[model samples]
Target: MLSRMKGSKILITGASSGIGKAVAFELARRGVKLTLASRRLDSLRDVVEEIQSAFPEAPQPLIARCDVTRRKDVKRMVEECVRRFGGIDVLINNAGTGVYGNAEFTAIEDFRAVMEVNFFGAVRCMMEALPFLKQAEKGLVINITSVAAKHGVPYLGAYGASKAALAVFSQSFRSELKESGVSLMIVYPSYTQTDFFRNEKKVGGARRPRGPYASPQKVARAIVRAAESGKRNLVLSLEGKALTFSQGVFPRLVERAMDRIAYKLREKQEVFNE
Candidate 1:
């Protein structure tokens, strides 16, 4: 378990928007020194300015450029954060992308791209941050996986697979880092109102939004608390948790049920678009 945020040096990737941006705000309120990273420097600067204005007394956050898909960029971001803050207390691998496509029809490149951002991207960040994480008196790693990780969905084939891989990686990585005094937590978030859909790649065209989704701020608060509590893994949303648990306990039945739902959703989207 780690101490509650008093003066922890934290780095959050994808900090320009969504859960990452919200987490940055919440952490700043708690007096954590932040190193906010994203691909967009302008957005990063905007978040930094917003937070600084809100918490004028707090330490100004460092905004670093990071493209999670590029290993070198991830390393540079971590190194820059360490240079700015001395060492990293917590690293949140929150940068990811999505794709909406059927398994058979989904281009291999698209699947690889999703995997690069959602899975390998996290891996790159973790690898780069490992040195500084080891240096911290107490270390935490939070991988922002998705609820789709535990369950199958049709349009989100590649995105789901990537998040599933991330969950598995976090589980395994947690085991390895436990004895090293580094805590790793996998956060499984259900659909949330974020820019994910805006930037999400389309399969046939016009991606569909289905089921329950929570606010990003709510999930961000949960993440900060999870880090404070040193939770191993957390799943947000009641419906999402139920679906994940059901899938795990009865894989075949859930798969069958979801298959029917996926078929219906695809048909619905096709009809609606036409």
Candidate 2:
């Protein structure tokens, strides 16, 4: 599978850190041509330096500073990737933002903001890259979603909605692009040990769950392997697969469990502000 990706032109959003960063390193090791992007230029430079040092023979990646929320940034990033790499064979939509709180008090605008990044951001990249992807022999789009998308958690209602939207969008769009030779892969990863929680917009009233997080490297390897193997849907962690199963077999039981968790997590607190 790794040999299959060698020298393939691939673009990854949110490549500055976390799963994106880890994926960048893994793919570089696999000898893929890359265009690594994020909103932060400095961090991306650091990634390049590290990748160059570790894998001197690997094809050097093109770094683009992109904020997925902006149409201009996404469009320009794709254009530059095509200009530099000739064409894009793989598009990895890993950029996302989340707000933490109950849906009632998280503010509708916050939900929209999350949607802009988590949902529309991926959409923008897909729409921009679809043509190039179709031109490739077997173009692939990998959407990094979450297991939370399967269940609406208490404090993460907004985040869940955004991922759910992306998952559903990917499902429908996958079929649309099938005949075009463009395949879409949806990855539902469980809680990962990343800066995501530290950077999340905390709406208070609830605390994050502590425990059993998957490392970014582990998730990254899984994603790359899934793409190489041409897997359509990849769900990480035993918890994620179980959640998917229980939802189908015992819906009300699962809802009751969530209700209990929300009750225990609920408390009075002020929302964090900028």
Q: Which sections of candidate 2 miss by over 4 Å?
A: 267-274
Error of 2 at 249 (Å): 1.0
What are the lDDT scores of the predictions, listed in order?
Answer: 0.86, 0.89
Task: Give the number of the best model, judged by TM-score.
Answer: 2
For every candidate, C-alpha RMSD to the true structure in Å: 2.0, 2.2
List candidate 1 segments past 4 Å from native: 1-5, 271-274
Model 2 per-residue lDDT tens digits across residues 81-159 = 9999999999999998878876777778888999999999999999999999998877889999999899887778899
Clashing pairs in 1: none
TM values, all candidates:
0.94, 0.96
RMSD of 1: 2.0
